[model samples]
Target: MGENLSRRSFLKGAAAGTMSVAALGALAACSPSGAASEAAAPAAAAAGEGLAETGSYDVMSQMSLLNRNMTEGAVAAATPEEFIVQKGDGALQFAPGGDPLGITPADFMQNVPAWLGEAPEITDIAGTESCDILVIGAGNAGSVAALRAQEMGKSVILAESQTYDEYDEYACDMACYNSKIFLDKGTPEVDPIDVMNEYVRKALGHVNLQIVRDYAFRSGEMLDWMMADHIPAEYTEKYAKTSNYKGNENFSGQCAGQWSWPAMTQWRDEETNINMWPFVIRSLHTSLENLGGKVAWGYQALRLIQGDDGAVTGAIFQDIDGNYQQIDAKAVIVCAGGYGGNPDMRLDLSDSMRNLAWAYGADRTDPEMIGGMGRDGSGIRMIMWAGGTMEAGPRAGMSIGKNGAPGFAFGGAWPCFGPEGKRIYNESMYKFGSNGHLDLMPDDSLLVNVTDANWETYLSYQGYGHETMDRSSDYMVEEVRQNMADYQTGPDGFPVRSFARFGKEYSNVWAADTLEELADIVGYTGEAKENFLAEVAHYNELCEAGRDTDWGCDPQCLFPIKDAPFFASFGATGGQPSNGLVMLSGVNTDGQYRCTDGAKAAIPGLYAAGNTCGNRYGIQYGTPTAGNSCGFALTTGYCAAEAAVNDLA
Candidate 1:
């Protein structure tokens, strides 16, 4: 009856077309006879009676709008006790569901998701192979592990699900502080301690401090070593000498309250200006083959073969021809990337990201089209089935704001307004931090940014690692203009940018001579339009005053909207938000890269690196430098190989 009442209230709220805090509080009180339910009864009754009286109740709807609908104090005042889930760690507010989708954490951990059904019986093995170290997933980490292990004189087998051509392009940048290349170019030395400390703070102390410290100190040497024999020294030297952030007068290591140093080296080939990551990876594969290592292409790993002692001994694979093959190994390193392609895993783990996922139509299961391309959680699931543990709930992910457009880049301190036509966030926030706020907004809500003619000058104020405006202003503007000029007019006569890669079109960018016309194009109507103009006026006042009195945005980032040709950029306009390149969190692992148990004890014979390794990022993917994801992949993959080899010895 209690559950039925909850369902009835949910239906009522849905039918009423308003999921207000009061409605939500009523739904929460559906559970019977508890102090929490007792405390929530009045709010529930008022909301229920209001709905019953008018067939709709929305006076307190603004209370649920996490964007700019209500002040912080008002939100705090309206927050009900039932919404705050008290945990051992701390009080978690607005946790309508204690677990992801209301599924208990214990249930999530114990039951295998339907997508990852029971493992297939290994009754028929058409072929058999053996190796000292079997590396799964020929991505950034897997390839590195295979190469490092082969270089250590261990027989290695690197298996990949995709064809050689399919696994070509990858991370375009590499992070390595104090490398030989940086030293040679006379670049200022960055304190790795400061960087790691920032990482810990961003991750909320959920990261393995030892692993972070190791990466800070040894990653530079690993970078030097990885490229020593693979990429041409000339290309490395050229990019190291070049590639510094340009056009920013107030160039500093800080932007939007985030600390970011110019530590990542963009891997671009000097001859063709193409990404050098694939070239280096191809070179490594060639060298591995030359050194008697096997590269098994198109062989998808199905499951692990554990011995009586519960140690993973080998793995089962389904080849391209659908024939089952067995590869026995003393040790295995799972680096099949994270579970970004697995919607079930993402939905199960990322409680905080659910709204963001829904808002952007990004809750997808397609391996190629999903935010984390080609990551199907095969590696992580295999490890989990073999007794490995995942990092705690509220998993970290890389959400770098809107992608595939020439709008504001991630970490850009540009003024953005929410659906309510009110300013959203301290515009001077790192992309991830700002996107975290974006996640709190109602699903399908469009976040729009309005900027005037002097937008280029304001854009230069941003200095975060990912969107550091590395090129000249002329170059940046020219590139954007070229793309914008290519916009096609649909039947409705609205200009839309056609993203050929995804077969989708979006009319997110617009220009108008007046704020009113711009507001109409961006779908601001009635009260929203009035609020939009008022916000612009207030913002202009702040700009003229040379200070942001409201959100405390950096002075340089504040610009008046008086100039004509006002431009606007809208996110979630195409019904999908930007989910950066990949998800960052993964299986719980120790400093040695061995997958750990609940007690942090290493699970022998199994190792994880790259995105498959967890406890690297805290509850969110925050970084003091760009390319640390790829950097950690390279560093941990190499070191995991070293650890496996040494342990075997």
Candidate 2:
């Protein structure tokens, strides 16, 4: 039953049912007189030729029949006894009815597949190749480093994770810097001193002074480098035009009357003209190639190679096809971006910054959003593995978005929502005047209403105010009443009504009606809500008087809430999660950006730049000081290259 069938036997069996004339003739062709000679001459060859000529059996048909037989044999060979089952009590039992092997489920399982096979066994002790400088990560920083180093007559090599086309395009493709918005406007400002100070104060709680001073002082020079390199002035101007300068001025007092200077007027246009990321990368790549520098893509650096004394020497990388290569260099520059992609890394760094969400204006619904595939925190992990310490900074990450919401907006600012759609916060609260900006002081305020019933009703309202209105009176009254009824009686007992859900479940609730009632509903037991209501009434009175006394909330901007069903939503303190906008306090370095370990001076070959190198800004987020990130990236790249060349010489 298990015999391997031969092709001739199979053919004989097949032909038994369908005897052909050619086969009969082939048999008859042999004569008795020359039987020995004829039989040995070629009857089999003639029969084969006849079969071929007649096309009796095609190759496909033969293969199909063979496969069928194989499949049938495989199925017949399988038995239920071959399977091993595990009992509920965790004992391994033999499969029922006759398999003698008595194999258990435990014996059947294997370890998870190793995506990368066992580490390469190194047989040859080949010496390392020498290079003047090595640039890690072929993104903006590394590319610029290699280009500049080569220009200075140093041999440089660039290693990137993916091919150039598939490299970190997300950071480069989008206009990342805040300057892009300013460049869209006609005028941009350059107050490096104040801008730097403001940045540190707002971002870092004004703690690190020296760091902010250095960044502010160097930022202007960084911009100048970009211009000298033939990055279009128009691009800078466009960014200035669309820049959020006014908003920054309103939020921070340090920028009062500080307008875009002529040199800083680079961001006053509306087109994607001077974005230095793409321009710099392409140009630097070409320059490095021309200068005899080699670029290797699709390679990932797994670990840093160190010396006996613990001085960094080089690195080991795994190439695209699983080949390992050790790159020897006098210096290595780590330019990989921050940990925005890795949620675990984010949690490790700061628990509050754990939400995985897109930045504002990012299209989460779009399949092609940058950084969508999430390989973000490799750089941080790699450095940690290399024995580097992370600096103390703001724990910053994006907020949790309303589940199933169309898009995500930053926290801190209150979003407007009405019965129908989404809305913006109070516009007047964002205005900046000549002397100072109008800051909304809502930390201790509360919404007050008239009756307990009305208060309960207001707390459960689904509708929000209009974008411009900031307070939707009608929607507030109706929704609050509905909510109160539902809370007192069960949903089944409450009157039936229909309203489109606004935002996520968390944001669906609203509060307002008469001021006192609104206060009770918001759970303000003390005079806190009452006092705030009194202040509101007084403010309304000031509006009637056409002037404000306690605080200068313009009467024109003030709207009276004396009407029936008056309500107020409690305002809270704080802004969106920090994104490390302004750089401040980083590893100390010379003009070459080489980091010192604080025990001695900096290591001869090492260089640092961008946010990693630090000492740029202090602590402010979203300063109208646009183009700072790019400037730092370019300046550090150039400085690192110069240092490398000098060291080689």
lDDT of 2 at 596: 53
Error of 2 at 165 (Å): 2.1
Clashing residue pairs in candidate 1 are: 256-428, 360-576, 360-577
lDDT of 1 by residue, 1-649 (tens): 3545454455555666767777667655554432332333223332134332555443342132232333344333234553354222232234132211222323334456666667778788999999999999888888889999999999999999887767675676667777766666566777889877888888788887877887788788887886687656665555432334332555566765667766666655434445656655777788889899999998899999889987878899998899999999999999898877676676565554554554556643332223434388888889888888888856645763333222453124467887888887676655443355665555567678777766656656665455444543233335455644443322122343332111123344567778998888888899988999999999899989988878887776677888877777776523344345677678888878888877788888999998898888777666566677888888888888999999899
Best by lDDT: 1
**Relative to the true structure, how large is the alpha-carbon lDDT of every model?**
0.68, 0.42
Error of 2 at 294 (Å): 3.3
Q: What's each prediction's TM-score? A: 0.71, 0.47
What is candidate 2's local distance difference test score? 0.42
